[model samples]
Target: MGVGSSSQNSSAMVAIKSQEDQGSAPDLKPKKKICCACPETKKLRDECIVEHGESACEKWIEAHRKCLRAEGFNV
Candidate 1:
C-alpha cells in the first residue's frame, strides 16, 4: 500500500512538472521587438541620459521601464 501511494504521488508530481514545463512565460517573448517596444519613452530616456547623465535621468529611465512593462517586456 505504501509503495503504491508513493508511486501515485510521484506520477502526480511528474504530471504537475510537465504542465509547468509546457506553460509559456508571459515575459519570455515580448509582443513587440525590443527596439520598437517603447519608442517614445525610449527617446525621452535616451536624450535625458545623454544630456544630463544617468543620475539625472532617473524619471525618464523609470518611465521607459514602466512603458516596457506595459508592452509585456520584463524590462
Candidate 2:
C-alpha cells in the first residue's frame, strides 16, 4: 500500500509539473460578466430604451456605452 501510494503521489507531482511547464495551472480568478458588470447604466438603458423610445434615449445610450467601456467592454 505504501509503495502504491508513493507512485500515485509521484504521478500527481508529474501532472502538476507538466501543467506548470505548459502554463496550464487552474485559474480561479473572476472574469467580467456583462450582465452583472454595470448595473446603474444597464438599468438606465432598460428604462430609457425598453420603456421609452430609442431616439429619446440617446443620452442614456451614450451613458451606457461609457459605462460598458469603463467596465472593459469594447463598446
Most lDDT-accurate candidate: 1
lDDT per residue for candidate 1 within 9-71, as digits (tens), equals 999999999889878754356778989988999999999999999999999999999988888
Cα error, residue 23 of model 2, in Å, equals 22
lDDT of 2 by residue, 1-75 (tens): 777999999999999998888686444333687788678988888898877789889998899888777766766
RMSD (Cα, Å) for all candidates, in order, is: 5.1, 8.4
Worst 10 residues of 2 by lDDT: 22-31
Regions of candidate 2 where Cα sits further than 4 Å from its true position: 1-30
Task: Tell me the lDDT of candidate 2.
Answer: 0.80
Model 1: residues with Cα > 4 Å off, grouped in runs = 1-29
Candidate 1, lDDT over the whole model: 0.88
